[model samples]
Target: MTHPLRRGAAYAIGGAACFAAMSALVKTVGGDLPNSVVVFFRNAFALLVLLPWIAWSPGKRASFSTRRPGMHLLRATTGLAAMYCFFYALSQMQLASAVLLNYSQPLFLPFIAWAWLGERPPLRIYPAVLIGFVGVILILKPGMGWAGPAGIAGLAAGILAATSMAAIRRMSDTEPAVRIVLWFSVLGTLVSAVPAAMHWQTPSPTQWSALAGLGVIAAGGQLLLTRAYALAPAAHIGALIYTTVLFAALIGWLVWGERPDMLSGVGGLCVIAAALIVVVMRQRGSRTARA
Candidate 1:
């Protein structure tokens, strides 16, 4: 029999692959569609895909009820903003670079938690954060004249993602995962619609197909990641989440001929290392609190 940790790792990697594929699909259709439209469809189609799952699981249906509408709105709004920035970055920048920047969410998470939850992280996490920012600077290459507005947008995506995560943490005590996800999807679609309508362009047949797949894949990846965390300690499989960066890099290289320069490559490594450190430390802190 496979060890539970190994299985969890497998599931995490699988989720990473799904997300990478979803990103690639976004890049594919992004050429013709507005980012707003893409964001709207992502939420709309994800809701469509999510409904069946809830329907199939009888118990999960009741999870939709929530006492905290305000918190749900905060999470959904921030998450939607992150999606807008991330998708825009994907449309404009190298797939690998955009994905790497988005993954830097962990670098901002500590500060967000500190501000929102009044939880101070350990001193050791600071060095990792410093190293991660150094990596971010290298990737941005601002002084070298390589970084562009898209790079800023990509980094902004990370910050917004961290904020959304913090909001999720705030509500995790009383809110079920299903309810949180449902609220995000519902509010995301509704909020994205105003912009989507302003920028609507009928998608081509191929683009329509890709957009649909993007939603389904996004929801599937979320489910796989949830399962992975349920099966093992986050410290055991958190690093596996970075496989999305590797997979995105591979897809970029093959599909778009994107090759990050040496600086960007090194920076990506730094960011990944820093994120892993944060994940491990966060897990340790959780365990200590429980003990």
Candidate 2:
């Protein structure tokens, strides 16, 4: 039998794979649909999927009595901003580059934890964080002068995502995970409505199919992620999350004929390695504490 930890790791990997598939679908649709429209439909469909669970479990509703409503709104706003910038960056840049930039979230996690949780990570995490940043710099290659405003937007998206995730961690103690996701879907959909309406292009039949598929895939990804977190610590699963980048790169190559260059390939590997090191260190620390 697989160990519980390994099973949780599998869930994390599966979630990343599902998310990667969703990203591929998003990229396939490309600039054909506006980012706002895409975000709205994605969350709207996800909300539909979660409705059954909401109805079946009354406890889920009760968990929303968050003491920090302002924090929830702030997190939601940042999350929406991250999604917008991410989709915009994907439209403008290479998929692998954008994925690499976004995966820097794990590196930011330590700093956010220190600031928000008042818990400093051990010194070992510093080298891993530095290595991860180095990978980002390699991917950005200052001398190349290839980056533009979109690249900066992508970085901002990463920061916002990391911040939102930290806020989620903080609130998780007081709220159930399902409620957090439900709020994200509802709030994100409502927030995107204005922009989606403003930039609405009547999706063709094929585009409509793609949008439906994107929503289903995104919902599945979120479900898997939720299950994974229930089974293991976030730090234990963090490294496995990088698998999404590999999945994105593969999908981009097969569907869009985009390939990662030497810099991106090296940098991507470095980032993944650093994330893995961090996860391993965290797991070791947990084991020691238990001992």
Candidate 3:
């Protein structure tokens, strides 16, 4: 790889690792901590982390004052909902299953783009979408007791996250990354506060450290991810983002002795393959257009 591509790969893979670690931490909090409680700290502390950069960074500080407040608010609302579902899924299911389920976000992007931006997807996307859902069915195994409610939450998380992420892509056309990330933190923290307060559980000292660490880790992942995309075109490094799932599985096994059965493992591979098809095709089209 060329220097920039190599740098982008490092940033992207490292970002994915951070995300994997953050998700593992979320799972560690376990059922004792409500999703709302964790979501609140994830947002609140992320906001604290972003404030300094926005206040001081030469380029980003100016982007703080945005003209498109409504778009930012909408992304925040959708992202906040996505975060809760994902956290709930992580709490309820095997770490690998939850992460794999959420990976289906890419399957929804084509349809979202068509509706939101009038960007018609290539015909190939249709088949990829079907393949993706079949993978979901395999992973979900709806009739199985293990994949019941948690499976549903995981799917919902993927769809909701896809919506928010597509909107973020559109918004990024006009908005700065700092602005978008900052607003997500702001709205997520504010929106989740009441519910978290209502379902409050006092953490033990160790759990408190974990909760604080969650915020820092989550924010760090967001920063690295944002910078990665800024440094290189998504087409060049997008597939690398799936490293998070691999990293998560490693963490799940080492930290919690969690392992997916054969069926679930097959399903996860299917989802990853289908999502890769979509990404690879899209990147090809982008290159074609540029050429």
Q: Best lDDT goes to which candidate? A: 1
Q: Please name the candidate that would achieve the greatest TM-score relative to the true structure.
A: 1
Candidate 3 C-alpha lDDT tens digits along 1-291: 878878888988988898898898888895788888898988887788777766675675336578888888888888888888888889988888899898789888888878998867789877877888888888888667558777888888888888898888787778877677777777788899999999999888888888888888888877787788877878656688999999999999998899888888888888988898888887787688889
Off by over 4 Å in 2: 1-3, 58-63, 282-291
Residue-level error in angstroms, candidate 2, position 56: 2.7
Candidate 1, clashing residue pairs? none
Candidate 1 stretches with Cα past 4 Å from truth are 58-61
Clash tally, candidates in order: 0, 0, 0
Backbone clashes, candidate 1: 0
Instruction: Please give each candidate's TM-score.
Output: 0.97, 0.91, 0.94
Off by over 4 Å in 3: 59-63, 287-291
lDDT of candidates 1 onward, in order: 0.91, 0.78, 0.83
lDDT of 1 at 232: 82
Worst 10 residues of 3 by lDDT: 55-64
Q: Any idea what lDDT model 3 has?
A: 0.83
Q: What's the true lDDT of residue 170 in model 1?
A: 96
